[model samples]
Target: MGHGTRDKILIAAATMLGEDPTAKLSVRAVAARAGVSTGSLRHFFPTQRELIDTVVAGMYTVDLPDDPMQDTASPPAERLVACLQLLLAQVGTGESARGYWRALHAAYVASPPSDDAVHAFLAHERLAVHYVERWLVRLRDEGALAPGEPGHHARFLLTVVNGLLTERALPGDLTRLEFEARTLMTAASAVLRPASSDRP
Candidate 1:
């Protein structure tokens, strides 16, 4: 499907932000990147804050595939892993992706609590929580998660994932991708199948 002007603007903005984390994201810069005039951009986003809010909201609303846990065609464990992998892939160590994340984080930190920014940040956070909740619910239905508090477990796992992503971004003794994935899988498996004596 053909993306609209606003969509194109958002995409261009995201691409530029991803390339240069410190980008100013000015009307002129975004317009130039999108190959649209400032007037065209202003038609959709009247202000810089409006554009930033839309981009943040857009980040959360992006679609993912249907839950694999609900799909009987695939093994539950494999499906869970696939879902986790999808989340990881989004914030992986790719230069562009990392740059985008850094830029977003910097903006969040620098900006004061405006209604637009707060709304978008809350929306994005809720989306992340929702994504994890869905996965946990599906796993619970598939008998992977134990009885009691699936939402709590989901939140905990999501927090862990977020922490790992932060660590990956910072300078430190970075964990290898394989090791990080394995660690998450092992922790999840332990939480879901406490009865199993095997440990990673």
Candidate 2:
């Protein structure tokens, strides 16, 4: 029963995260979602940070439905661009993208965040980095990518996506899509230098 209750709490937290990436997993919100008392939720996860860390950490193991990394037949750049698109898809565009950035600013930039808030933000950031690193690692192992730190390459790619995500929230014309596609392609190709070659 103890384990079951813990699982319920975790499932509820994860569900809330899935529903809204910005969902503040307050003890009351999570407990109510899980159909458990606040005390029960606290017994399983003593703090909001712990609950968030556990949920986001689990995301590292969850495979995306159509992971581009699995398409070995595709060129490295194509696979990587597809992967970045997956990230973009999650954030969406226009109002949806605005909401994501809004939540981020409200939580981290509007005022000083508590330690727990900072931890939650970092947890989600790490999960994004982890997914990108996995793809880079696979390309490296297959000799498709130049010898370099996968984490560095992952951050580089994520930096590109991050900029694009922010741009999506701002007003732009139809050509924005064209520019975005070109930018993603360039970023992907830039990082996918062949193993046999040296980057200038």
TM-score of each: 0.60, 0.93
* Model 2 vs truth, CA RMSD: 2.4
With a 3 Å backbone cut-off (N, CA, C), the pairs that clash in candidate 1 are none
Index of the highest-lDDT prediction? 2
Which candidate has the top score in TM-score?
2
Give the TM-score comparing model 2 with the true structure, all chains together.
Answer: 0.93
lDDT of 2 at 7: 89
Question: What stretches of model 2 exceed 4 Å from their correct place?
Answer: 194-200
In candidate 1, what are the lDDT values of residues 1-200, reduced to their tens digit?
A: 22588888999987764455345568999999998999999999998778876775665655576745556687555666667667666767656445656667776776665665566456556667777777777777767676668677767777777766765666555456677778677657744755452356
Candidate 1 all-Cα RMSD: 5.7
Question: What are the RMSD figures for all models against the true structure?
Answer: 5.7, 2.4
Cα displacement (angstroms), candidate 2, residue 101, comes to 1.2
Q: Per-residue lDDT tens digits of candidate 2, residues 126-200?
A: 898999999988888877775578888889999999999999999997799789989999887777875346455
